[model samples]
Target: MKTGSLRFANIHLQEGPIGLLTSSLRKGRLSQTYIFAGARSVGKTRLAKTFAALLQCLEPVTGPDGSAEDAPSWRPRPTSDVVSVGSAEDAPSWRPRPTSDVVSVGSPDACGKCLSCRRVMAGSHPDVTFLRPQGAEIRVAQVRQMQELALLHPYLGKWRIFIIDPADRLNESSANSLLKILEEAPEKVVFILVAEQVERVLPTIRSRAETVLFQNPSHHAAREAIARVTGRPADEVARVYSLTEGAFGAALNLAAQDLPVTGLLPLREAQVRFLEDLERFSGQVQERVNEAPSLEAALAVVEDPDLLLFPPLLASRKSLVRGLLLAESLPAAFPVLFSRVFLDVLDKARKGLDKVLETVIARQKSAYAAEILKEMDRQFGMAVQNLFQAQVVGLLECLRHWNEDLFHFSHTADETWLLNLDRKDDIMALSLVRGLGFAESGIQLLSRSLELLSRNVQPVLLLEHVLSSIGGRTP
Candidate 1:
């Protein structure tokens, strides 16, 4: 019930995959193999270690009485710091008391004063073994050695524990070898396999062990921790938690700094500017398609995928979706031509979406149309800038092909297009916004139109003449 007790109490196990492991433990029927799966930094490895410690703790946990509790004085370390374990004589001292904080098996939760705890924490525990690859992946040799060690009797405690920090990192041969042992694991021997992505582990391995899933702490939990550690006001802590995307470690790092966590100011400013420019020109999108640097600045804000920054390209689609939704609700006289054109641009933008952009999809409905358009414009503009002149030329050509399809839609007729003449005129005003060579033609206009766009100059005057010729304005 203490502030940090839930951290180690395995309370999160009450729900999700972690709950399965908790149920098994309460029944005194622990699985020989267990996989802890989740995203990176979401606490899979951390939970695996805690489960291992609980299995080998000298003191019986007081909960369900599946096992008798050890006498008082054995308690787990509240953090990730490991407690080294060496021998059986240290067993009595190694017992860890229940804690709210989640601690790994190798962490200080083992009571370093005990011989077993000291050896394990120091990475020299005889009965405790760790099998990890030396480089990019875990190889078969490591698995072979593990097999050899697993068959041996424990040198100290009643049980021997093996922890594979990144179990999914094992190569095919190594995984198969480990799976063989799991199929026939000895009594009193436990294997904890920690994986960021469970599906990557072989199905045979997955089927044998109990699975535990750990979610990152909630934003509220992170904010509270930040306040406690930094003595900062709740408002500042709340702000930092928002910036960190609810990551506990990230929030803690920022809170520890003497300065406030407002370093993201530049990013915010660039996002704001990009959005403002987009909205101001939503009705004249064609003229402003070349703001590359500003576009790059927009993408940079959410570079860290876990933080879930909304990218410019995805933002564009959201804007179009909103516009489409609005168009559906508007009067028949309202022109939705610009929204249609913007939607065409968005359909093509999805091809290069990064993970961060995909995560932002859920927020699209809540985002403003103008804001989405701005982000997309910025990203597309920047992308065009990065390409060679010829590549950019080719892209515009492709865009033109897509644009030509729009004219055939029944919605582009005079009656519907006239109300939004200012926006429609800009498109009609262009020398050529359609047909086979439209990409080539579009590129030619880009340089000239971009300059005019930056100056806030409207070239739609000519568009009005063209629309009038087609009876668009009179309708």
Candidate 2:
């Protein structure tokens, strides 16, 4: 309909899947549904979005069938034929001869800058949408919405494209909901579900879509490519590679986190306060509960995060752990360590129990208090599930960087690229108090903690030991 101004960028390290899909498009053999499964950070989502852009590009490189490559005219409605890129031919190139030029995309290419491509890349294309699990699972409500929208005609492009990332997150009900959509989607619509593991996805959904596989590129090549993007020296790249264990996403994040080391001072302060308050107030809360004759008489001192920004609430240890895996993550995670989990419900239960001041009333407080604690325990259990926690290695890496920067700044006091710029004075003060020696010892302690953690040592004991050892020595 319109001329494509977009060009495909050779950004992925793994080009096999790209070439496969592009060649399929040229041959007019695209499928109605595709399962682009791969390891995390191998570019499945990136490729999926790029493909959607190509489909919506104003100037599409016409396929062997009858679509126009450079046609200057317009076709508001797609010919009820093409999917994102199917394998079987829809028709021979025998439609009305186009007045404009037609060039086949032998290699993967798109006029990425065109109006259509731009909208698609920006994720604003009327015909394209993305879906991912909001929390632990993709609910049936989400799939139902997708199904309803899939039946509609394209608002701009000839077809509608739905990209579902980490599709395995669909629980049983949601997966069933998705399966129905896949089984009955229209010819002009396309579904691309990207997943890291196929077994987690329902087999019926898998059966309906063509499974496309992607693998990690060699670490040497991945590092070089990452270095190009980061503009870091070879040695630094090597360090990142080693830290990330060849994961490009992790490596990129580490390289980009070159901020002032003092930015974590507030978060560090919050963490200490939270831990101290948690330990300090629990006994008082129990005492108040025991003394109270009725629920109306209970009160207690506790932690809250009203002063912090909290959306998608930092109420779970998994979320807290994830948020703290980077220096950038500390503020979010640190507040959560003090913030109430499931605050709305927890508050309702607490108020229902006639308690205020965030008291952890003892089970002996009466039936109401026991019920409140029971609910708290249930919610807390859910939050502490292993599935939600951030990787230990990630947390360690972030801590390692924090202490490393403090050590470097203590002597050099350089701010070329501080990770915690906001806490410059605090960092300087800490450096003054502990000096370089204290920092080096803190780093060693953290390293030992990581080593013990990796070896499956008791997490609570190891953490307590590390905290105790570093307690007075740190700022």
Candidate 3:
């Protein structure tokens, strides 16, 4: 087996930033440590692995060599192309490059026949390291072990590569451990750190590495990848790709499950209806401060990341708020004006700002646009923090309520909610509430509360804040 390499693979290569980065690396000018910053499912991990493979490929490739020994290592076999005219015609499958190429990924591009490549593809490669958070965070101990491993020579390949996924998950200690490695990395020891937010990592780490940004792929590219990988039709692939918001992993995951296009109907309808609801609701509240509590509840549900409908709603809310402020209409929308305290949060709902920015760019002043962007970012950050806190709150509330419900009825001092928590859904629900121990009861209560609150009735939403008096518990 040869070392794994993704160089010149038959995969449908998406053009743009990722393509540019890959092209540069193929020319053998890779950075010591690379920060691949992008949204989830933007192929950050995939690209990093591919680059690592290329760097580790033992049979180093050069441009179309004239010598016989330098001949192409692999060639595409015979295949028929779809006819240009009339009915869709069948195409023959290309041979030589087996489907295993997609499955077995490693450095120096895993040649199918090499023992090293085969072992790596089989997940037994001693030289290749893929490090991810074992739990909520990547601990310093885990990172230290990785560093120790990095200090040793590669058991097989010339280069030793370490890929840290979601590198932002590293706690301060873990990150600091990695910083030491960066300071004294041995020659040919490479680090590829993939993160959803590059800024979250230590600035020193960012300064030591080149930042390679990965932009979202177009619907066309996502569709092609889904089709090629899943053998699905173009229309079906397009549907799933669109529904996933062009997240390749989400789309491909759906394809693997063989879910039908109709499966996305509710998700799509919810997105549209939720946006309209927020626009109409925000307009109504724009003149009423007394309505702040109710509006907040509604916004919470709309912005629920699980629903994926909040971005548009929040974006609409931002625009409506700005309009009211500009027109000196704060008195009319007292509740909304009060909520404006959190307006800095509009940033996390990226989908909305992406849309709003496009609309405002044509008419809004550059200075005003800059201000709005800044506020949006603040709001976005706040929204994320609030969401996390809310989840934690939800769990505590569920636990308190579960015990209250149990003790209130049982009238026994020796009882425990853990013993009587029923139903898998209840447990699943509590897990969603976040920060609560993943006990069955906690999960169930969270699930029930979320379901009840989403209906927009505040009275039925009492459970949402039941834990306000509960002891503050850290996640």
lDDT of 1 at 343: 31
Best by TM-score: 2
TM-score of 2: 0.52
Candidate 1 residue 201 Cα shift, in angstroms, is: 1.0
Alpha-carbon lDDT of model 2: 0.55
Q: After superposition, how far is residue 263 of candidate 3 from its true place, in Å?
A: 7.3
lDDT of 3 by residue, 198-271 (tens): 88899989888877877766545556667887798866665455344345665566666554222212222432
lDDT (CA) per prediction: 0.45, 0.55, 0.48
What stretches of model 1 exceed 4 Å from their correct place? 1-22, 60-124, 216-232, 239-246, 249-475
Residue 348 accuracy (lDDT) in model 2:
41
Kindly provide the TM-score of model 3 when superposed on the true structure, using C-alpha atoms: 0.46
Give each model a TM-score.
Answer: 0.44, 0.52, 0.46
Which candidate gets the maximum lDDT versus the true structure? Answer: 2
Order of all candidates by TM-score, from best down to worst? Answer: 2, 3, 1
